[model samples]
Target: MSHQRYEADLRRLFAGFPTGVSVVTAQAPDGTPWGMTCTSLCSVALDPPTLLVCLRAGSPTLGAVLDSGSLSVNLLHQHARSAAELFGSGAADRFDRVPWVPARHGGPHLVEAAHTIADCTVTTEQAVGDHTVVMARATQVTSLRRPIPLLYGMRRYGSWAEDMENGFLSYDFIS
Candidate 1:
């Protein structure tokens, strides 16, 4: 397929795949907080607790995260869409609108996020066409909220709602 066709098809294909939302955060040398909401976070290993995140090329936070040698992955809950938008935006003072605290390892952690995974360093970075994939070693993990995760799919956000039992065998059995 042509490059344009491939791009369009990829977008359509990805839209069908539901992904959990997260915000990757770090602080610059001048104590300025930086972050970006991403669905590109993936687990790379279990024994070593490693993960990967893809950041767009030329993002200010990307270079700062590389320089800081660490980052915190803040998992957004189903109710944190506003926080997600704030971090995803290109506007300054994104942190001003969100409640957060510094991670034990020194990166910014969203105080109300579902959870946080603190990575110590970028073990490797591969430059893709328009983004760079960063592999990091997780040093810590913390849960700030319940396990209800925020999901993105088909260009929308949705949550799993439990149906009450209506004398149905399947519902009663599960309940």
Candidate 2:
């Protein structure tokens, strides 16, 4: 298979595995905010509360993150599709469209859109392919609401559903 075909196949395969959506945000030295919607976030370790996020190489958000040595991973809620789209659209005024406030550390926290915010300090970064894998230690976690995580998969959006019988939420892909 050609390289392009292989890449497409890999993306399709990963699309089958739905995951929560998040916005990785950082602030530049001049107080400018930068952010991008990201699904490539994962918990790396528990002992020190480590997490990782992959950001596109040369992205302004990535640059600001590196320069500031901090970031905030805002976990979007089910009602935050618009914010997700806005962040991903590369709009110059993306931050203006969303309601947010400065976090305790790192970048601003999406007030209405995110159910949780993890304020982290950058630990390490490695360039990989067209993206940079950023590792950070979460120094603070603020839970705004219960987890009705916004999910992305199969090129669609979904959310968790309450399973009353089990008294828990389950992956109920609406799309």
Candidate 3:
């Protein structure tokens, strides 16, 4: 297969797997808030509360995180689809239009877009291919009770639902 076709196929395969959406935010030295929408976030540890966030190697957010040594991964709720689209664009003043409050650490904590705000300090970072995977230790966390989390799948934003149709629970039972 051609390289372009292979890349396209891989992206299609990836979109089939549902993932939650998040926005990673950090601060520059001049107290400017930098953020980017991403789905490449996951918990790596439980004992110390470690999270891994992957960002494009050339992203300005990555640079700010490196410079400030801190970040906040904001887990978006289903209502924040518009906020996601705003952050995903190349707008230089993305934060100017969004509602956010300053985090004690550095970055701005998005008020309504997120259900959980994890303020972390970077412990390590490695360049892998075209992205930089950052491993950070959560220094503080703010979580809110929410009904459903925002989801990304098939190149769209939505939420997860239980399948309750078609005569469910039809597996043969021995009990």
How well does each candidate superpose onto the true structure, as a TM-score?
Answer: 0.87, 0.94, 0.89
Itemize residue pairs with steric clashes in candidate 2. Answer: none
Over the stretch 10-89, how does candidate 1's per-residue lDDT look in tens digits? 99999988788888888877877789988898898987889899988889888878888788888787778777777777
Winner on TM-score between 1 and 3 is: 3
Residue 52 in candidate 3, Cα distance off native in Å? 0.4
Give the 10-residue window scoring lowest on summed lDDT in candidate 2: 166-175
Clashes of each: 0, 0, 0
Any idea what lDDT model 1 has? 0.77
Ranking by TM-score: 2, 3, 1
Task: Sort every candidate by lDDT, greatest first.
Answer: 2, 3, 1
Task: Mark the 10 consecutive residues where model 3 has the least summed lDDT.
Answer: 166-175
lDDT of each: 0.77, 0.94, 0.87
Error of 3 at 79 (Å): 0.6
Cα TM-score of candidate 1: 0.87
Clashing pairs in 3: none
